[model samples]
Target: MAVMTETEPPPPPPIRGRTLYRLRVLRHDPTALLGLVLVVVLAYLVVAPLVAVLSDAFRLQYGDEAHAGQAPGEWTGYYLWRVFRSPVSRLLFWEPLLNTLVVAAGTTLFALVLGGGMAWLVTRTDVPGRRWLAGALVVPYMLPSWTFSLAWLSLFKNERAGGQVGFLEAQGVRTPDWLAYGALPIIVTLGLHYYPFVLLLVGNALRRIDAQLEDSARILGAPRRTVVRRIVVPLMLPALSSAVLLVIGRVLGTFGTPYVLGLPADYRVLSTGLFQSIRDRSTGVASVLATVIVIIGVLVVFMDMRLMREHRRFVTVGGKGAMDRLGRLRRLRRPAFALALLVFVVSVLVPVLTLLLSTITRTPLDLSTFTLDYWLAERLPGAVGFPHGVLRGHELWEAAWNSLRVVGLASVVCAVAGLLVGYVVVRGTAPRVAGFLRQVSFLPYLVPGIAFAAASLSLFAVARGPVPALYGTTFLLILVMAVTHLPYSSRSGIAAMTQLGREPEEAAQVAGASWWQRMRRIIFPIQKGALVTGIVLPFVSGLKELSIVVMLATTGTQLLTTLSIGLVDYGYTQLANAVVLMIALLSFTMTTLTQRLTRTSLASGIGG
Candidate 1:
């Protein structure tokens, strides 16, 4: 036996050719095959559309007539040259680019200062009402981004914008034009909306940090400042980087805030620029803008990845219950906690309350002239015009109905695909396939919503393969929304399935249960909570979404959010406000329901 082992078993039967070798490897690990299928399918669905946009950017098109001195399908640098070097490029590209950078940078700075300060106060000090503040902080993020923009406009729109007087004017305050629109309002609105991201990320890290490190430094005769600067700050860098990256990524791609604010002042950020280019039939220029945005996105994502990798090396695990407690500021604690509470109230509650108030008001800024007519009045005469009362009108009801139908369809598609991808990634044995699937599934998260919509428009405006023309159909909106939101639901599914161990499935299999039977009886039951969350979140997101569907939607297929955009375009601020409020309510209710469902499931899982 020893001699036979030394002979190396005759070279293991001379390993087979490439195809057979792949088959053998797959036979040993079926998970890889599943992952490969997922990756290829997702690439076609997600990556192919992006490629189409890139290809579109280099092609020249003429306006129906004689080709205009340029070949129809010829590759040209006209778009790039015009966008980057032409005289109008400053107005079209550079100014907006600078504005985008300024807004993103300012938003990041404000969010970090506000969120980090609050996180430190709550996690380090014994702040009063920390629990309430923590809960309230995230509410702004849950609301639609445009909700804040519209609320701000309602509270501050001056005479310059041609809208009715705002709340400030009603209160004997002359609001400045700068405050009502442009980069200032956008920065403030976006900052307030996204600060919660920083809070959650930084606060969680703060909570998990071991207290002993700070204490050890203190015991070594280090001062509080020294300990903070040398010990705490170093540890917090990774979290800060992550928060900044996330906030920047979000702000860069944001369309609603910029659209609501920027369009009024001709403040064209990349997203708005792309939207304008597309609307004006400048597809080549729009594609270039989309590419630019995608490049920025990819760069930011790379930075985030690098930071996360670096964070892994700094991990500290130790004994239980090691948390540092900062000495209270005593009398200052109440004031500090109150200020934090005030910020939450102003950012989350006040804006939402203002929206509710504006919805009931007959005129945009006249708070005293309250009326349920906006909510109840059905089909006012055309003379009422722009903000005409159509609350209970057939069109309004139809848009709402369409919104529910599209969002419901999208949610189902996303949930099912996300769960399948998640299951394959978590339980499958193929490392190569799993890694590929995971990366491609997350590609949409790196893409701006407007860019994605533009890509979809470019791809599906004409038929390809089994998929027919989807340009004006409700199905296009559903597909775009579903794919754009896949990352969230897929990530949620992965996390949920990972938490659920394999023992149940293994036991089912041992009892002679088939794969589908095991999935139905054992796996699905355990993961139902996550599945609901996955579905509900996308439903809510799709309900309030503006950027992704703005390009693809037509009059016949308009969702409520898109309808709100149309109302805005027609200068119907009050009616737009009403529509926005309805969308916000729907989103808020869905989010609350999902959170409750998630919590109940988590609790049940823990108890069982």
Candidate 2:
């Protein structure tokens, strides 16, 4: 009997049994399954491309074989040496790096001064038309950043580029190089575009401050400047720092403004330098620059988070009955109003009108040279490639349609995927998987659009494993845009889902409803408004998105933005201005409609 007992032991559990058990568990718990799927997809879509970019920076690229004496795809340190240690590194990296730092610092300072001051006027002081100014000040943000640059050139361009002089130059007023095309114009234009960040963040912060704090300081015989320094500034440091980081981050990666204004003067920042490398097929060099840009962006984001945490340690405690009255301007009210109006004119109305004027007149602001030819004519001299008026041409319509189709589809994709991501993040039983999914989904927000595009071009441009090469395809554009803009929708989704209880989905599950059925019939119906907001935000953003598509779009998939920039490159300024106006018109109309529907303008945060 003892010998028989040793003859047989329990059979080992089959591998198939374990796998089937996991499948069954996954089937029952859709959130866990979804989280797993999302982690994989986001890793491939978001993380893989970044890895590819980083890898490329250390590898020998195709055209660098001769220079590096290594085969393409082999690991090499030549790119690093070329970018940071070579003789031409000054032009290739150092100068651009220095220029980027200067521009970022200058733009941050300018935006903070302008935006923080305006925010104080609107939120703290009794400024005239505060409501209207609050809304109007953010208009430049909605327009593409380069819209200001184009308008700047229309008004201030010198003979630097040689083809077409600006309005001042046309009038025999030769604009200076510094004011026309270098860091000054770039800084000012980008500042005007980004100041809204400060307005929204600082304005909201200003509102949250108890007016009694300032009044208390003033009543204690503290001078106005002393009161501001001791009380108001300390309370608002978090927001000011946030705005500074936001402005700096944007300036770091913005391409259109710098490219349009900088190329003529050989003024290159990291963005334009990366662009030049990409255009010249210097993939290794572009990868190095892009990596540097991305690292800077990540640092900025980390700094923002750390600063917010540090600032919280010195929180201002306000009483329940805190008075929030607007500061009386007395006799300065009218002048303050005029100053805000003048800013609006310079930032919003002037750029828009300048572009409109350019489109109408053969020369800017010249009424006698006015002609409808730019918009309505079928043919005009010197309009070489784009022969017809923008309104009359199929090119404009086609590009508009492409923008709508690609961006529209991408927005819908983002909304759905974002909701799924939220579901997984909020309900998944696996904490690790859920946390990974959440973090991965938000990674694209840290990577700049241009750098992301370059990464996408590097990773997806060629076939990998079973995936086919995706370079120059509309699908690639849609994919890149959806990933780049996912943060807006994902944040919207998470916020909406956080307020919703799991009871509805649970009840549906008890009724034998499947996961997809519950999502479609219960979750989606309940979160329709959030979903719409998600779609509208991304759609509006993508409509004006230039940096992402500029690198990904092909001739067949030209968006309104690319088409406009192309005209600019071709020396067709009026034609380009016409397209820029169309983009602004569409963007403004959509934002206005959204406001009408939701009782919430995009700038409502600042206004409140």
Winning candidate number (lDDT): 2
> Model 2 — TM-score against the truth?
0.95
RMSD of 1: 4.9
lDDT of 1: 0.81
- Cα displacement (angstroms), candidate 2, residue 43, comes to 0.6
Give the number of the best model, judged by TM-score: 2
User: Can you write out model 2's per-residue Cα lDDT over 153-192, one digit (the tens) per residue?
Assistant: 9999888887678999999997889889989999999999
Off by over 4 Å in 1: 1-37, 64-68, 170-173, 317-320, 324-326, 363-367, 379-390, 426-431, 495-514, 600-608
> Which pairs of residues collide in model 2?
none
TM-score of 1: 0.89
> RMSDs, each prediction?
4.9, 3.1
